[model samples]
Target chain A: MDIRRLRYFVAVAEARSVGKAAERLRMAQPPLSVQIRKLESEIGAPLFRRGTRGMDLTEAGQALLARASEALALAADGIEAARAVAAGSRGRLSVGYMFVLANAMLPRLIPELRRSIPGVDLDFAELSASTREARLLDRSVTVALCMPAIHHPEIQVARIGAQPFMLAMPIRSPFARLGSVPMARLQGRPLIALPPPERDPSSSAVAALLRRHQIVMPIASRVETVHSAMSLVLAGEGFGILPACARLGAPRGIVFRPLRDATDSIDIAVCWRRDSHSPLIRTFLKCAEKAVAPL
Target chain B: MDIRRLRYFVAVAEARSVGKAAERLRMAQPPLSVQIRKLESEIGAPLFRRGTRGMDLTEAGQALLARASEALALAADGIEAARAVAAGSRGRLSVGYMFVLANAMLPRLIPELRRSIPGVDLDFAELSASTREARLLDRSVTVALCMPAIHHPEIQVARIGAQPFMLAMPIRSPFARLGSVPMARLQGRPLIALPPPERDPSSSAVAALLRRHQIVMPIASRVETVHSAMSLVLAGEGFGILPACARLGAPRGIVFRPLRDATDSIDIAVCWRRDSHSPLIRTFLKCAEKAVAPL
Candidate 1:
């Protein structure tokens, strides 16, 4: 049944007069009468009986009235539900994140996105730069927060901001005494903590930075989560490379030193499918733009 | 995009040879070639490069391959999920139960249904008989394991089995001495329990049974749950009416005796919507029949 017909029927039923129902519906009486008659014909049963007194109900009319009430309720609920989704108020959004942006932007971006779109459900999944590039092309995730590497024709990237890499070390170590850690100081270090060995650009970027200073030390340990690596560093275990955002979780026994030299600072970008048209994607993109505006 | 075409394209991509993919797909190579060409034409991009030794991916071919794989995966998952629901292997089934059935068939039927349909998700709700009747009419629950009542056109009921109503009293009560409780013995004895003022057929049936014997007494109390009513009986606080199936949880202090010259019996039925055509409805009806067969 057309939802409009049910709404008109409900209004007529409630008003008890066709003229009053049309007035309440803000439409012409003839159109309202025609819609009700159409509804009756489609259902093969009259919804209301007219008499000199007013509209009353036949046995069939009573049954239709009950059914019409339920059908109209469901229709109203369906329209509202559709509107909520179209307005980006309700739905699921799977986000792919790179380690650098995950630490730098996620804490603030996610909360802001939630406030901007109250009912947009969030599902977080970690994606290395390699997998994220592949995922964006395939539309596996609606949005990807990562750095732009080799650009693919099927993907679109929105540059958010950039941050320089920082060296994380034990507070009591001699490296902490330097105002800025020298590139040569990291040379031949017995060990360096690394992010998960998955093809994350952050890990590769750190390796490249080390390589630029002619430092080639075998990775001692690889950790999946940043918190675990931070905990180990705080225990005076080993030195590691991290972005400025990772510095937010600076443990009491750990110190961060700026890198003195680099070919270029890292840039973070939100990557999406070239054809993604979801309203939720636009809402999230807006929040991302606001998040990186000051940075 | 057609899911079948996507599957065929994936096979070609993985094999890198249309002839080999056709052989693996158990189809003629000519049709597979035509189908792939049609797909390329539809997408306005050539998805394969002609080579003498073996087929290789052009840039467009690689992009289409990724998108095709994703589409095929989602289509396959959606079909499997829908089929699982149809077969009662997954998805939720909300059930409503009467108070007496909750005490009797619940303990056995619940566990049996779970064992028989391991993946049949259940959302069992405690409901009064009147509420169960209304909800069944509204399609609020997929099924109602309840007693047969006044037939309504919108509701469908299938009789599972019947159990005789028995009288229960404390072991110390005078009526417990008799092997079977006689109608004359209950006269003017202050029958401590009866149905609440609501329109429950079980209570009405019991009341009709009493009126047939021309016996009436002040109701000492009215309780909703069978467990609570049984508690009152076991405490020597009142004489109560209970279904024979409720003997499963007979407390140590209580003794039950069948009523002689009484036509009171409880008939259990699986009630549902008369016009429910949902596949889940069909599968659950089958499971319920199998579960209640032992009774």
Candidate 2:
């Protein structure tokens, strides 16, 4: 009903137990219960049902939950928007980056954003391209630096640059000595790739490329993060097809080589909500465009 | 630095203007500026560089911005955690859901969760998958009904049921007379799909199916909501693929056909943070598992 009630409702809904919600809200249980009851009464519906085992939502409670969340997010966004406007340059922008590219790209972009947006505070999170597209549509972040052109209707993507995919081989490998293995020869070879189970874009892209080449699948090793995968490649675990850009901080004893066919290239894109109203966001997108324009 | 100072820093960082941050924080400009300076001194770095255009974060400020967001999120979660424990069966649970499914699925799931858990309040939000995933990782929400099998290392996923994908044909279409079309014939026909540009499982599933049929990429009439798209279909626009379980509440003019390949399906999943220690979350996940077991 009210923002405070909505906040309380969100807390309780998330906790899924009144006693816990009360504690999280920093209030006593009885008062929290009373507030919830009042909310249910105001809405003329039962918000929750409880029993010996636990607590859960009623039909009405579920309906209220959706509106409550949107209201809260909008409220939060509103406050941030207002503050950004007032500050003339400062605001919090949630930013999503791929772990593989964070080191190469962020070091340059963050500095500029800080310089230009000044009052803008950035909330940073790492995500795969799949996740980045979702975030862009949800307006969770003001800006996203991810693989190029995911094609969501709700988001606008600007090309950052295209980086060719390179095979990361141990410096002493036969392929390395030969400069590059023909795509055909590498067929049926045991290649190391981050498994689909981990949801890395590079992994999926590699899988797609392999599929295109009529390879049923390649031997895969699951690495939790890009750094770990790169480490394994350096340790001679297997060959890794990494994005050329992610190789900026490439560890020792690993070499990058272009594929015979350059079709194995990926583009980096800067994305944001199509309807974003934040000036800071607008400025950052422009800056991002300029930063990577020549590349 | 104190949490209050961090809050101020976040505000200042967001607003980029001391005066605006002060206003939002409900304090005077001078005091707020001093607080930021104190924080900078404590951290042994100049957090922001003042300028006529506005305030900008120095290198240290950028680092702090990322850290500060996590700290604030943790603080917020700590409060919720404490509340959940105290509320027992009568607390709130903040639920995150995708926009379209929230309407159809939540009405049913809420009551079921309430029946199983009991005395629980529900707070809901229309959350994009990326935000929900991030919040779940951050413990901002205890449970979320989302697209199944998102591959986040820190997030746990439980597939509740398959939300079948259906082909929605316009009332005026030749296929509408048949009540269903040969699934293969519909292939390569002009089709409208929710622009998945986000690599969302639902969108990707549709794309994969279309690709399997060698369907020319559907003429995207527009990127519209499921409901709106359905309405357009009913009004004689291009056909669309929708989750069979979704409540379109559409008039009788529209038609639906289950894809011929039974494997064609989108999964409904309940997602929560794997590392969460909250007892309430444990209880909720347990109860939720039972409610959706049959589905």
Which predicted model would earn the best lDDT?
A: 1
Residue B62 in model 2: lDDT: 59
Candidate closest to the true structure, highest DockQ? 1
Consecutive 10-residue window with the lowest summed lDDT within model 1 chain B:
B74-83
lDDT tens readout by residue for model 2, A94-157: 8887777777777777887778877667788887744777777766666788764566677788
Docking class of 1: incorrect
Model 2 Cα lDDT, one tens digit per residue, B1-295: 2556767888999999899999998889999999998877666546677879779765447556765655565445433433433434545677777666665666666777777657677677776644667777665676777764566778888776777777787666777666455567775566665656354544477777777766664575755466677877777768878787544555578877766664677877777777544355666666556655554
lDDT (CA) for every model shown? 0.69, 0.68
DockQ of 2: 0.01
Interface RMSD of each: 15.4, 12.7
Prediction 1 global C-alpha lDDT: 0.69
The superposed Cα distance between candidate 1 and the true structure at residue B235, in angstroms, equals 6.2
Q: Residue A188's C-alpha lDDT in candidate 1?
A: 70
For model 1, how does the per-residue alpha-carbon lDDT over A1-295 read when each residue is reduced to its tens digit? Answer: 3446656766887888889989998989999989888866655545566767667543344444555565444433433443454445665677888765665677788889879877767888888644777776665677887753436687777777776777788888898999988777787764456543355544567777776777776666666555567777776667777766777766688888887875445667777876655677777778887786665
lDDT for model 2, on a 0 to 1 scale?
0.68
- Alpha-carbon error at B130 in model 2, in Å? 80
Measured with DockQ on alpha carbons, how good is candidate 1? 0.02
lDDT of 1 by residue, B71-120 (tens): 44543343344345444466567788776666666676677668766776
